[model samples]
Target chain A: MNKNFNFCIVDDDDIYQFAIKKTIESLNLTQKIIAFSDGEEALNFMIENLNNDEELPDVILLDINMPIMDGFQFMEEYIQIKPKLGKKITIYMVSSSVDQTDIDRANRISDVSDYIIKPIKPGKIKSIIEKLSMQEN
Target chain B: MKVNTNSEITAILATNNDGIVYQFNTDAETLLGYSSKEIIGLEKAPFFLIEEEFNNFRKDIANRYKENLDSDPYKLLAKYNGYDSREWTIIKKDGSRFVGHSTLTPLKNEHGENTGFLRIIKNITNQKETENELLRKNQVLNAAEKISMMGHWQLDTIADSVKWSSNLFNIFEVDTNQALRFETYFNFVHPEDKAIVSASFDKSIKDKVFYDLLHRIKSTSGKTKTVQLLGEVLTDNAGNVIEIIGTCQDVTQQRMAEIKFKGLLESAPDAMVIVNDSGKIQLVNKQAEKLFGYRSQELINKPVELLIPDKYKHTSHRENFFSMPKTRKMGEEGDDLYGLNKNGIEIPIQISLSPLKTEEGLLVSAAIRDITIQKIAEKKIIEAKNSLEILANKLTIQNTQLADFAQITSHNLRAPVSNLNSLLDFYNIAETEDEKVILFEKFEIVINHLTETLNTLIKALKTKNETVKNIETIMFDDVLIKTKEILSGQILKTGAKITTDFSQSPHIEYNKFYLESIFLNLLSNAIKYKSEERAPEIFIQSVIEEGVQKLMFKDNGLGINLKRHGHKIFGLNKVFHRHPDAKGVGLFMTKTQIESLGGNITVESEVNIGSSFNINFNK
Candidate 1:
């Protein structure tokens, strides 16, 4: 696992956040992990540090049901600054909702690679990374 | 044997069989609508007149063979369905319908026994119409008299005597009530006019001159009516007038609405024309000339129908106006109809039809207003509405596109993640018993997560992408029967009581397949999620509101907490309670199917109480 490849998670539920964090560690997916309680904080933090060469996360798990600046709104703003950051970044949508509307919205964004329902685990995380590698080649 | 002529005896001196000149009569010819020549000289009666074809007026023949002629033939004519009866009908020479009277009687020889028959006939058509009119006049008198031709009166002298005309009674609707008398005359003259009438009469009587005046009278019923009285005193050679004779007419309604009608013509925000019944322009204001390109003086004598389109000219005949009887029914005016313009261009107009009685009779004065600008304004409104509809459609399309994107992303991404997680967790399970339990938990968690993602997709589609399908009149019992058949054994096991009543009639406009799904899903859920207290009781009935038909299915099963999960009840796999089979998918699918068929579902429920779903379908 590369420590430089930081993972960022934005989810409102503490239980979901804890589970994703535990799965990341158990799979040896990455060494560094950062979490935000809501979409607004995550988006703000990412924009403020967008200029920093190593500040951007390699992967993001964006939750749909955040209180302010929902995942869709964050994606709209975040996509504008993607080239400026000069980094390989992928966003995977995460939510407890099984609503197709949210899934379809996530699929429409090029930067969003996939969607995952709550309680993400090691095996699911590995498959996402593998798919990303395949696409990059 | 000629009953009235010695010459006929000379002719029997001419022919045989008693030369029955006895039958000769003037009316007998007229009664059959035929000539006396056909009846008198003919040996055989026309079979058309006799009900018994070959019998040849046989009963009359038998009586004639016995001979007695003095009996009145008219009553017998009616009895034998003869040509001279009081109630007579004729068969025309062309075999068409006719009206006539017929009679029959016996002719006797010197022995005083019956020998031959004599028949007398009369045609009564001329009197029929007069009596029929008498009948109609009795039925509704307002229709009997032409209400448009009104009249007025004036008493030229002071009064021990007075005068009246036909129309004064018409205005009072008195022609129908009682016999007209000099007192009936006083009953119609306005009370205020009474004093004026007396004063004017005294003045006129002293001078022996005529009186012309307008006055109001309180009719016998105390209703005030306006009347114009115009007449002179009729006198003997002494110049002392014997009595006052005059025309009294009601002008109440016209006197009130005339000023408004004139004002409406000039300042009427629109044009107007008043045309007499003969189709000549009686009056036209400035606005009308401006609209039609002709001065009122120029158009005055021209036919009013000239302003109407050629297509409508055929419809503007006086006969059309005369078709409906002239009745006293007021306020339900004739259509504010159409007319042509001077330029021969048809312009939309709102007309008011009123009757004016000149010496000529009723004239229809049309108060017309042009609606061209109003039509233009309506077109503008329609254009705006069309643009707004386009905008709404655009937004709906965008919304649908976004929903599709969400559904695809959620469904596509979850599979790989769940499989990888389960595979890794499975390896850990074999290492130790504690690890095995942990691995099983991990596997369950990943699978549940995957299931929820799939469910979200289904739920979103249910709410958004459901499209309408075939619509038909779906019978309630048939749908229920199909549902019961599908879940027949399950229902038997659960022992759920499902009572149905169509007594109020639940058949409505709906798709058969969708309606079937609606009942199936609901009943299945009721049995699947039964409240454990006792056997479930489900009530199903049809309801209607404002022409919309609804089917209500209420179950006494474990109900949902509407306050918490109300909005998401039909969401995919969003299970309300922890039942093993609580996938929450049934409601989502059911809702989709129902909505696709242009129907709706609404739920009202309380936690652990009961739930009732009312489904309304398009009619």
Candidate 2:
């Protein structure tokens, strides 16, 4: 299961955050799951630990809508500092919006590996981790 | 004295003291239309006299000498002796009258007693008729000269004398009795024109050519007249110029009319070109020179078609115009016309033609106007109209997208539902009772969020669908007072200083509830996002902008960075600041309400400085 792999969740809804956390734990995907209520918080954490690969997550599930900053604003700031980061992280856009414009926009970013419409299934989460684990091998 | 009876030029007749005719000369017979045999003895001298004239002469002689000479014709005849004569109307043998100058002499005896009178008669009718014809012709010439305002003069250069006809004296306003010297005519020439006139006259004499010129003359009456002087130099048999004779015509009226016509042409707004019936350019005004880049002399006598472009040369427009001349525009509407200048550059032009009736013949005057600037303006107007249509289409598309966005945002119902789905999946996989109970608690929270979101969406929908029916004139001050009272706690807590000046446009016709709500939302927002370093100083004003009633709310607050979220400032669920009460619903609802009644709301803001929101009311 590659339990050592760390995952991050950026969303403003606490219930969705809690549900995703439980699903990851239930499959024993990782014990090092970190969550932020919005893109700004996750960005601040990533900036604070830019060279600290051990502190940074291997993957991030980003929400499109939030207070303070959204997924697109975070990506704009992240891309500027991406070359300085020690970890090669994968990003997925997780949004409740089925709008083609939002989906197409998130997919156009080279850093965004995939766009997933919520509710994101546990099966989708497991595959994401497994894909990362295969990459590490 | 003895008479020469063979003299053919004179008539000889003799009358005795007793009034007996003895002999009629050969010339007298021809002069009196009679032969000598018919009148030698058949008629006495009394028979030859015109009775009325003889009676008048007899009366005058009796009054003077106390002698009635009626029967004693010889006594009257003796009064006129040799070398003395008197004109007498003589009756001929044919009873036709002949006027004769007759002379008388006494035929005396050796004792010197008067025996009879000898009278000689000479016929003078031909000479008298010639004198009367000359007098009639002279009177006719004077009349002609007076009416035409023209006079003739002869200058005998050799004699240094000048003879002027009567009208010539009138033209110079000089006394007719005044004698004219050769220099007298030159004195009347205007001072400015004297040099030219003298030079022309000298040239004529030196060159042996005639002088014809137009010059001004100031008459003795101080009246200035324009005169056309034409003179010819006459040479004697030896080829010496002996005399100069000419006519001077008063052309003042013609010259004045010409000057006025030229002034009118020069004052026209458009270029004027006058052409004769043969299509030859006769004159061009100053404007034509400026327009075609040609001097007037260069265009004169040139074909008028020289100014028309070569492409238009084949049309025969000028020929058609001359055939039936009238005042009209040159071409059909929308027909592009061009002119070729001296520089060979083509210019867009408009032309109007009018016929000029002149003594020479029919002429056409064309007024040309350069329309290059007008053409350019027309093109720009068309381009502007096209761009405006494009912009209008873009706005329409943007409006459609905005409506779609509103619909999508209201479907925020999906976010909570998706959360519930995730929560349910987690519940099904829960192995422990404690974990299941926690998932249930989380489910309740999700459901509550879902309920709250649904309520908000429904309220937003209601706001969008609400028809405004309670329109009334609501004073801005009244609305502000009520809003302040409602927000009294927050105003006092924050120490917000709200000032207002609604004197310019104090009130608006708007829905009562909407006005109060708008005032409440804006004022609360001002106090809510005020800068912590300073007390909120909010300024509210009402004004009429370009005849549209507007309300402005300005505040010293933590203004939004419009650059970051300007497009979504009034969008649903779009919030900028991290205030605890920031729900992002107030502005969106305010915009929807204002727009429902065909009003518009716009905002200008700077971070940490201030925000000014302007609302334009429809009514």
Candidate 3:
């Protein structure tokens, strides 16, 4: 695993976290798959782990539903921190909801590369990786 | 009343067939003032009766002598004078004329009068005058009897005999031939009044008191009559009470009038407080008692002020109630007047006081009606209006605040977002994955978060009451088609199948925008909550009932445990799914949109089998 490639997975579900972790491990695409259970915990973790040159996640697989801080709330906090990280973090809004609002919101964000409905398979993760590579080129 | 026979008596028997003098009766001679001496040979007789003086007599003779010979003596002499005959009078010795019946009959031999010409101009001046005087007296008596509604009857106490005048017999409906005995007359008294009649007789005869009383009488044919018997003690100085003389009058009409008048007073709706000049209540009906909440006994003899509230206690209207002229209505002036209840509570009442006048003086009567319930209903209406005004002001304030929020969230961020997108597109390429991932992820994450925040703000904005629009019929198929069209890519990607059944034609009565938003949210959630193990299957259907339309969306996805998250399922940002894409905005917006359209959404879910969302809308 490349230490330069650190990634984050924010979701409330253990099963979804396992699936996203397995997909990332099979591809061995990043150094550390930092996992957080909710938007608030993941937001605190991101604030503590900031570094100037450390590469932001090549991709982030974010689950929409959480207890106190859902995906929408996490984005509110995460979007403000993105300018300081100064690193490209490709986000794929992953959810079991094919809801238009989730799909629409993911499409609306300039930072978000695309939207994907879970459970995230290896192929979907590869597709997200391809989108990041395209941005890099 | 035959006084004496005359020396010459000649009878005139005349009819339309023949004018014959059979033998003029002696009374005819006396009536016409003629003897057999001068008129026996003369043609027109020495007596002449003036025509003007005997007009009715001439007509009587004509009527009786037309075809049949009348036995009436007056008619017999009357035929001797014809229509052209003048001066129906008799001549005395000196030729002085006196009104009388004159007869000229053809003298007959033994066959049937008409011997030669027995011209008998009998003067009946004195006799006719006496008959006229008797008739005049009888006419006056009849007139008096009719006017007084009275008739006379005589009873002989000795023979137990009763003799009634014509008017008296008429009252009993009997002929003169029917002997009236003491018992027969007593039998005429009504059975109900027999005792009274008997007592009256005892007082009149044995006790020597004047018998005057009102009682009922039963006639011979069993007809009951109300009558007044006024009699006096007609006795010699011996005081034998020889015969009872009395006048009886039918008084049934008067009695019935009294009964009906009493009934009217008792049944009248408006209270009749017959107060004397002393301000005392004399009569109070049941309605009056109920209106004032006092028993008639309690109200009577009490001053009318008991009913008047404290405000009018010292008023002149109360003091001079008895002195006022008889005015049928009270409160000619419009004023808010009231009455006091038995419980001493003052009830608002429309009071009308009236003066009932009699020969005795003026009386006051009051009509009171309670208006408490009407006053209360009016007060409630005023309160409701005040509440509605407050609600309107609060709604206006909330509406302006919402407009500001929408501008800051959706529009304000749009420009910055657009700039970020453009800057990213213009950037040069990086060779290394580490360098590119670092920068790209930062901008991407920021934009994504901004977009999600904006969408939540929009959800909150839609729930405000000020955004409610005019109601419209929501077509089931149209809304479903539009929402599905918007999420078509998501549907294809999830491998989900969506079908609609509107067999019942559930076109909801709702706002069009709200219905569209509800449809979009429910269908999207069905696809979003799909179980990983299987392809999603969703059915959207509707049902119609009496006045309501129900929409149902069922999905073969991971269902929720209603027992755990039931209360918060429709709440804002209340998401339960573990899926990474579940933003939790869809269900919250769906609930609000449904409610704003005057409808409700309910979910039935089990963790894995399936979930069903039902929406009930007014039609």
Question: Which tens-of-lDDT digit does each residue in B1-619 have in candidate 3?
Answer: 3432322333342222232234434455555455645344344312344444455554555565663433533335433532222225554455666644444444345656323433444345567778899999988897787676578888778677787777767677777688678777777888888898898788789876666899888776777778888887677688787777878886767777866765776687655556666677778777767777789889878877777778767647666655555555543344656777788978766656677666666766666556667668867987988898888865765564454444343323543354344334323344567745654665665567667767776665656554547678767788887888899999889989988888888566677877788788888888888898999999988887776778889999989877656766775446676566776667767766665555677888888889999988752
Which should have the higher TM-score, number 1 or number 3?
1
Give the per-residue lDDT digits (tens) of candidate 1, residues A1-137: 23335788987545456557767776775747889976668878877887664767778999875543567767887877777776678899987558866678889988888888765766788887666666656
Q: Number of backbone collisions per candidate, in order?
A: 49, 1, 52
iRMS, model 1 (angstroms): 8.1
C-alpha lDDT (0 to 100) for residue B199 of candidate 2 = 97
Error of 1 at B28 (Å): 99
Q: Specify the highest-lDDT model's number.
A: 2
Estimate, for each residue in A1-137, the C-alpha lDDT of model 3 and write its tens digit: 12336678987655345445655776877677878887777778667755644534555677665565667667777889987785666676766665565578878877666677554556776766665666566
* Second chain alone, TM-score for each candidate: 0.38, 0.57, 0.37
Off by over 4 Å in 2: A1-3, B1-411, B431-437, B466-468
Off by over 4 Å in 3: A1-65, A68-137, B1-447, B462-474, B486-499
Summarize candidate 2's per-residue lDDT along B1-619 as a digit string, tens digits. Answer: 1222322257777655555667777777766667878766654545677778767766665555566655444454355432335788988767877677777567777876677766677766666677778888777888898888889999998998899889989999999999899678889999999999999999999988877989999999899999999888999998899999999998889899988999999999999999998889998999999999999999999998899888888537777887888889854368889999999999999999999999999999999999989889979998999999989976774575466455446336688788888877767777899988988998888788677666766765676567756789888888988999999999999999999999998888889888898999999999999998999999999999888888999999999888767877887666778777887778977887787676789999999998999998864
Candidate lDDT (C-alpha), each: 0.64, 0.83, 0.66
Question: Each prediction's TM-score against the native?
Answer: 0.37, 0.51, 0.33
Model 2, global lDDT: 0.83
**Model 1 lDDT tens row, B485-603:** 99989889889899988767767666676678788889888888788886888889987778787888889888887765675677544466656676556787787666555566899
True contacts kept of each: 0.07, 0.59, 0.05
